[model samples]
Target: MADSTNQSTVVAFIHTYRPDGRLDSYMSELVDAFVRCGIRLHLVITNHIVPNLDSTALKKHISEQRLIEYINDVDPEFIFTTNRGGITKGIMEKTHAPILTWMVDHTPFFHHGGGPEDLFCEKDHCIISSLRHVKVFESTYPVLKGRVHYLPFATKVEDFKTSRNVVQDVDISFVGTYFHSGILENLYNYYADSPETIQGLLRLAGKIQSDPDTDILPLIEAYGIRKVLEDFNYNHIYLKWLFVNYISLNQRIKVLDAVSDLGLRLYGTDNWLHVGAYSLNLLGCFQFQKKIDTRQKLVELYQRSRIGLNISHHQAGGGLPYRIFDLLASNALLVTNARKDSDLFHLFGEDVQVPMYKNEQDLRKIVIYYLENEKERRELVQYCNRLVDRGFSFEDRVRSFFEIAGCRLKETGHGQLVKVDPDSFIRGLVRYLYRCGGNKPYSSQEKAAPAGGDRIKKIYHRYATGKQRLFIARQVVPLIPNGIIDMLRKQ
Candidate 1:
């Protein structure tokens, strides 16, 4: 056990890299929250531990040895990481600290070899994002029966609100990767050699799509295709992976393609361009104009968009994506696909009515109706926002995480803390605007601005296109950076 007397509860955060830095951002936010709770975060970047080497055996041995020594030296109360990719069985065996592995995505079977040399130790625990996955994980791995927990995606309550009135110039917005179509295509092409197997897989995909709440394993097996399973040496996990990937991509493509004509402004990677290559109906509707650079920028985009779209990944059958909460927090009129037995309805209850679509045509109709009916959309947005404010933020998740991990806070905090009041910031900005002869009260177009460093720019840009754009540019644009002002001019 760690020193309980005068020491803060140290957490060894295993920081692995993601191309878009989504997981890294989650870690950074959680670390900040835990820091406030007096947990001393010890960041261990995976790349630094083991270099990319040719010899797999040598690399594994070195990383295991290095990690063993490092864990012993740090003597953290527990090890916390997402996906458990960098963690090994040897490290788990050697360490006294309990490992809290947060599975943000589906449990990959590759992490656990076909044999018993899996990552699980008696003391280690799993925290999955989806409640449905939590149930599935426990049932699949009976050994980890009591060790799994459900902690859904959340946003910072304080940061994701509209305190300052701003205009929502954009109509529809989506912020997520289109996912890797090439990989799925290749898998399909491989089976293309076997027409029967390809057709079977497609039929299996349709079954899974229709009945999403049911496990994919059973669906695959029920399809009665021994060749598909036999081809992968009876690796059900890998097969499930391929089918779910296909279903999720299919769902996103279908829905996005349906709603593409309605001034849809996508914000994500260039992988969206491949949508057209995949389907003729898509016609590059998934093409993203801007890459949302930061969390703040994402919130701003949601805030500025009249409607924020959430297309659930196929795996998320009974659970809502974190984007649902973010869109609600940003006060975007959200339009999402209906999940079978979704956590959304149970979480919010019957009081709030969030728009959900059953199919592509339904989604298009819902989106169009919401766009035309402003009062009803805004009313629903307010209701959802209130529910989110009640308890659905990252702060709430941090507390839940600590309780589940059995970590207690120390009497006094160690890190330097700085606090900024949004109301105060808004007042100051309003005063500045007043000096610039913009004595007009909040306009019809402007709604509250979500918290961010570029908030001033969002406010400036809202009125930038209006009659006041030139006046504000002369007055406030001088204070903002030239580059930022130039960008705002384009908006």
Candidate 2:
């Protein structure tokens, strides 16, 4: 760990080649936090991501040799990268400073040839976004037990703090890519080439989707497909990636179909035409806009939207998404799909902080109800904003990260410790809930409620009443005799 008394510089390895801007956003917030803590940052840009970024701290390195020379010249106390891929093993072996890797991917399968264990040394530390990845590392490679940590996704709240001058022009909006081009076709061709293997894979996927609560690893083993994945003989990782995309794409289409009557706008790539031949025609029912590449435009869209939708890829394995935090920070009413083992119910009330649905019908009902009930929607927006503001800020996340990694900060006469507050206590309760309940609660009462009893009760009552009406409309009405219900409906 870096000493608090010593002045230190940290080198950050970044790849900005991708146009998604996710890495750019993360690096910007992290750099800001490090600067605030009095730590100097030297950015090492790789892969020719950007020809030039207007910053004196940035240095572009096109090869591993150059990167190593730069690191040696800087002699920084700590080295940071977003993932293992950002820094090569050769570079890691040459550097004596501690390398802190914050990984956002599902698993380090890309490092399969070198073995995931080779990425870390005694001086290295890893921070993963998914808890599942943490467990996999600890269990698969015991050497990384004490060094691995779990940190959820967060956003810079200040960046999203916008004036309420914009009108809520969009009733609901979804911003993501629709995978249809090369990867999808390749996956289909692979499956067609291997009928038996694909059949087994589909069977396993079907079982996992049917009961998401089941441990997929055990099921994969039982299906005897574990060896195929482990062999790495074929494109198993790519296959899994495509599978996740397929699941997410299907879910997004279902959501669009369910709420086609509403003003649902889609902002993403043009690949959505592969969903169906008539997908282009379906755009008539809802607005279809091209992808918004910049963060400013995205924040503007969120600010102008009444509701923001989040649909996680099935491979997330109950991990809370970055979009959830972004939506909360934007003060947009969030209606998302409920994860089978999510800690969201603990951090925020089931329906108060954010409304989550279990199925397509439930999602439609919740969206309609929230849209019609402006007061409830506004309250949810306020509650989520307050909760996110209290603890889920980018600064808070970075501070917690330093503490977890045992890196100390210098005393600038403002000696403040980042500790858990009342809001943090609510967030901490999520870990407890996951441990005790195995993230499976039979009923709403079984889930942990927040501090104020009266407020919770009032929120629950309002949510239950509206849900009951939706239930009667969808469930009860279908069961009633058609003649009598039709006559009653006519009256």
Candidate 3:
């Protein structure tokens, strides 16, 4: 081993097929951030995630023993991963490498609004940025508390530094697909089942004599909504929802079909592959599109693009995505329906903000404006690029990550915990929001405020749950491989 100051290596684990996701971008930014600091990074993707990595182009990245052997071979000081489903959890127990799980989205729970999985992820030493995520992890999983740090996503500006302005592929494009919970489903169905949207109803109410309050759905108690409640296993709640609404799937698909008809090179998980085969407007749909391949393409494609759209069905949970920064970095004008939430418009909205689309009308306005006012569109791109460059860029953000994670900067040379913010944290949740973007800290308050959540409860829960006993149990939890345990015994 070189014993150099920058000897640490980061490995990002993707258990599922995240061919198109923010984790990869986080990985990309981590690489640039670390390498610039002289630390090497190896992106450890699961075979499950990259089933087609066997292609000649991607063959060099293929490794049979991937994580297991790589940990042995590289003996990296740090391993950064997002989900803990299969491969990531498998790697955690199997390796001696001090693991760092970048808690991106721990499936089932994220599919629902909240759960103990977040807490479980935190206990495993994954630096978490959001307080909501930290609370979920802390309250649910007995083991993960201090292990999680407030390390925000590594947003970089370099991604948009390119001039890959090729001809526009689609006039207005958004890549997303989602399902709804009882709350969201009811809200959406109310709109879909009707001849008009809630926005339309509100407008009609203004013209006609009717009380607007009557139309409003009463707010559900925080603890009981489909989101992660303090007492419930949010993942289970969501899984149950998925099964019950199995038939309502048709109505959901119908909405997605309508969205697809408008020009966007859309693709999602395998279920949507059928939609492409059936619809004439549907040009193509694949199970997963490669991020590295797509990024290389998007660096050029976004330049010519007018309105890059993001519409999410659910508003509360999903935060700004890493891709939003990528688009801003690529200087693509982002049009989104993220008004109620904070993600895309958080930082860059001050400079080059994209308008929020309430329905197809807002979407149409953005598409046309960016199309007609070419000079204005270019200015917006430049403005967004400036925001991304200033501090919102992934590289700079992850460099902040390096400081927060307490990865001994060559100067400081000390390993410590980090303090990341809520907006970045919310963006972390948005990925779970079926194509929600991340990190929309348009104002200073979000950046400055501690991520919104019940802090006192989290503190009380820690001691009440006997964290000391749990920590002791975790130490003897029979996690290390027998061979490794024997090796240690012999030593």
Model 1 TM-score, 2 decimals: 0.74
Query: How does each model score on TM-score?
Result: 0.74, 0.70, 0.54
lDDT of 3 by residue, 293-332 (tens): 4455555555655666554322113355555656666656
Return the TM-score for candidate 3, rounded to 2 decimals: 0.54
Regions of candidate 3 where Cα sits further than 4 Å from its true position: 1-6, 16-33, 48-76, 85-98, 106-123, 127-134, 142-156, 176-263, 267-271, 276-292, 313-318, 345-352, 411-491
Q: Tell me how many clashing residue pairs each candidate has.
A: 3, 0, 35
Worst 10 residues of 2 by lDDT: 419-428
TM-score winner among the candidates? 1
Sorted by lDDT, highest first, which candidate order results? 1, 2, 3
Worst 10 residues of 1 by lDDT: 53-62
Candidate 2 clash pair list: none
lDDT assessment of candidate 3:
0.44
